[model samples]
Target: MNKVHYLNSHVEKFREDIKITIDVENIGDLTHYCNLHIENKKVTKIFTECFHKKETYKDLIKKLPDTVERLGLFYLTTVYWIAYTCHYHNDKFDEAMGHCLDSIDMDVPLLNSPHFCKKVYYYLNPIDEVKC
Candidate 1:
């Protein structure tokens, strides 16, 4: 079994209606996985696993439309985190920027929009040197 190293994980109340829990882990060899659960009037859970050797960034980005369809306006933070992790580990900043722009195009307010905006800005202008 591949050992998992968590990059980040947290649980928090999102807005007044939803609570979100997210776990992002690197399951060895640059493979990344995210497990996210959101609870409001109903329960929604999603698991996305990407293997670096087997998947290209384009493949990862292609899943966004389906993800947005499934999750609607909720839990995009975890998606952004997964994108950031994929880029950071693979040095694929340009693809990361594309992922961020696509997420923004969904045009819903994220639980932490400012934080996500900062990440997008850093991807556009790395001279600012903000830590993700």
Candidate 2:
């Protein structure tokens, strides 16, 4: 199978897994956000067109590292968004916090928001630490 086709299949499976694991109500919003970003980034056109030529497939393989990094960022962003939504709206604060902390523990670049950082810090180092 061509690399593009293989990558596309894996992505589709991941999407399916996300749909199964995420709340049904949230799936529509997540799909809309992802589709909007894909359209704005022109990533859809690139992947669709790249499969037509052998050279294009090879080129994609050569750029695999960058592709993987972008994909990782996409996955992380999705997880972060779900965690944020769950924490604030779904009353799944502990689960959401665990997801966020797991992401951080993976040593990926941290989210830049101070509010998120503060929440995580407080989560790790509870209020009792300073109460005494």
Candidate 3:
């Protein structure tokens, strides 16, 4: 969310429920606002791409930290857009912010990939399960 002006975030962690509050500068001329939601792990409830088994989604969430950590700028940006879209639509703010900060610990990456690369563009349409 480079173009996005990050404002603040709040987290409420309980035994079974984890809620997150994220505030980002809105697109266009809109004022900043907060988007909040609780964490959900349902496979069919998050990713737009379909998986044959629920375990795959679980595994994906499990591996998200390593994946984002290892991602080049291009991929990270891709993920950010997905998260930003999640925030924009307010479908799954927790999942979006979770992936945004790497779910295990809420720490933003200091500096993203520094390699000079071409801008990449991705197009994802909203699906019944996940909104792009």
Candidate 4:
């Protein structure tokens, strides 16, 4: 089994969500994967329509602090990419581990900054994305 690492930010509903964890082996590649894809139309549409905040990726990026916004958008877009691949393209997450870990890395930095933590809560709370 591949080793795994958890992100400090996670979704807690009826149960905690493991969606933020990533394979340890892919840690080195996270930045590459994240940088490769900046704009996703499908995820953008979902964020704008499904969520009440009416947040397009760029909107969230503009409103939050640079580091916080980068992490948040990276996290959101990565998850959206995974969902998009699974639901629309029929790709299993295991086949998309690179992207998954990239998104997970986005949240790793927030673990160290209290300010960013608060910002993460503020940014994520509106979308029902996670708990601090």
Candidate 5:
């Protein structure tokens, strides 16, 4: 499997809410197959609305030092997920993506996107289309 599992808490409310996971092997371009697409307009709209949280990123940035310290064996890999989440709706696409590409090259998964909601139902979220 490309990825043994993927957390789906950000999507539909499954019974085992915390157990929401999708399995796809990490070979070839598995982005679409992995269901990372924010397909549902409702979900996408919700995400678009909530994605603009300077407060949240600021909080995370403040805690980054502590958060990093709390990481263990998978620290490097784990941090990118956060970075990805940040860039998913982040305003600073260029900078965030630079970090994301580096993360992916290092074998870290970046789930964030620069794409718009409508296109998210189709492909990668476009950085230039974020509804500021």
Candidate 6:
């Protein structure tokens, strides 16, 4: 993100904010002291709105990249959230499966075993038999 804009917006009173945040100058000196504000609060808030099958939820998820999907322990959480959103929430089965298998690739375990995603939910969901 553009740090100069952040420095101008958040820490308006401090030059240190400008130097460390924008220029990355004397970086080691402010390693622990400088806290750069990226203004990501809005993005974080949007993702925190849980899962979505369509409408606003789908629109919001489209804004994020798949790299973000691989972060945190959200792989399983996101998969199930998608399932619930499609099956019970929005009745958008095809879209949910698309997200579960493709976008999130919730199936890929960054761990030793990649089958982790299927074994947990996709593999056992009786609903998969329910005709798309």
25-71, model 6: which lDDT tens digit per residue? 22122112112222244444444443332334345546554544332
List lDDT for all candidates, in order: 0.39, 0.42, 0.33, 0.41, 0.31, 0.38
TM-score of every prediction relative to native: 0.25, 0.22, 0.22, 0.27, 0.22, 0.24
| Residue-wise C-alpha lDDT for candidate 1, range 1-132, written one tens digit per residue | 323323212122232443233234432311221332333222122223433334433444445444343333233334444444554455664455457667556323343444554454444434655698
Candidate 6 runs further than 4 Å off: 1-43, 49-58, 65-80, 83-132
| Residue pairs clashing, model 1 | none
If ranked by lDDT, best first, what sequence of candidates would result? 2, 4, 1, 6, 3, 5
What lDDT is reached at residue 110 by model 1? 49
Per-residue lDDT over 4-85 for candidate 4, one digit per residue giving the tens place of the 0 to 100 score: 3232223222343345444333322322324435555444444444333433435544543443344545565444333334
Location of the lowest summed lDDT over 10 successive residues in candidate 5: 24-33
Best by TM-score: 4
Residue 29, candidate 1: C-alpha displacement in angstroms: 20
How well does model 2 score by local distance difference test? 0.42
lDDT of 4 at 72: 45
Name the regions of candidate 1 deviating beyond 4 angstroms: 1-47, 51-57, 65-111, 114-132
Tens digit of per-residue lDDT, candidate 5, span 1-132: 233244543333443323112221221121221233322333223223333442242333333333222222122222223334444545564455456455344322223332222222222222466586
lDDT string, candidate 3, 11-33, tens digits: 22222342333333322111111
Off by over 4 Å in 3: 1-76, 79-87, 103-106, 110-132
- Higher-lDDT candidate among 2 and 6? 2
Clashing pairs in 2: none
